[model samples]
Target: MTKPDQIKNRYNRVARCYDWMESPMETAKFSKWRRELTRQVTGNTLEVGIGTGKNIPYYPEEVKLTAIDFSKNMLKRAKLKYQDDPRKISFIEMDAQDMIFEDNTFDTVVTSCVFCSVPDPVKGLQEIRRVLKPGGQLLMLEHVRSKQKFLGRLMDWFNFVPLNIWGANINRQTIDNLKKAGFTKMEVNNLWRDIVKLIKVRNIK
Candidate 1:
């Protein structure tokens, strides 16, 4: 199977247990981070990798929300999770590296724990930049490789496990990939000892 197919299959298999695996820790550790990052989302907002629609409840009601996931099974579960919500969130199956939207289509793009799983992080970020309007903002909540030598080495060692099981990497340099994708101005806050971060980048065209 191709790389994308492998990713999709792995996520499909894990779709049912995805939220369960993270809920205990995420509820305690990431609730504040999710609220802080998502509160700034406004206007035409696109959330890439809207796994199980966990971010849906946090987003403000006024924003026009469009969410996409590469895994069809993931999108299916997200739709079920948000079906009763009054906010009309459009969910689509889309590859972040090659989105179908026209250029300058979104005013803001948000991602949470997404870049680590993208097969080509820079290419996916470039697509994000392409779809976002000039001066638009990119908000992200991600866990990346630790900067500390010993901890970073530990993450590198364990990275292969997640990659093999879920096609997710634990040691991606997502902030650097953002720079490589042409996001010049960024405000980064270390959320948890530099392993998890809240990053805000603006598209200055």
Candidate 2:
């Protein structure tokens, strides 16, 4: 199978248990980060890799939210969380690397621990840049490779387990990947000693 297919398959297999598997971090840290990121977005917002709809409850009522996931099973789980909500929210199955949205379509885009699982991070990021209006921003709460040599090497060494089990790379150089994807105006703040980060990148086109 292709890389994208492999990722999709893996996440599909894990969708049933995805939220449970992430509960530890979700409770201790990610929940807070998700709230901080989701609550701040405005206008037409797109959420890439909206796995199990973890951020759904945190979104403000006013934003017209569109959440996308590549895995059908994952999207199914997400829909359950959002089904009864009265807000303007839509869910679609879409690959981040090749979104169906028109150019300059969104005012803000949000992601939570998503880039690590994207098969082609730069391509996915570029697609985000493509859909974002000029002056629009991408808000991300991601875990990336540490800059510290020892910790970085450790994450690299054990990257395969999560890559196979979760379809996520634990050592992604996301900041550099952002630069390569044409997001030059950025603010990166460490949330967990350089491993987890809260990033804001403006689409300066």
Specify the highest-TM-score model's number: 2
| lDDT scores of the candidates, listed in order | 0.92, 0.92
Tens-digit lDDT string for candidate 1 (47-161): 9999898888899999999999999888999999897788888999999999999999999999999998998899999999999999999999999999899999999999889
Q: Model 2: what TM-score?
A: 0.98
Error of 2 at 180 (Å): 0.4
The residue ranges of model 2 lying beyond 4 angstroms of the native Cα positions read none
Model 2 lDDT per residue over 17-127, tens place: 988899999899888988888877988999999999999889888889999999999999989878888885799999999999999999999999899999999999999
Error of 1 at 46 (Å): 0.2
- Off-target runs (Cα >4 Å) in candidate 1 are none
Q: Which run of 10 residues does model 1 get worst, by summed lDDT? A: 1-10
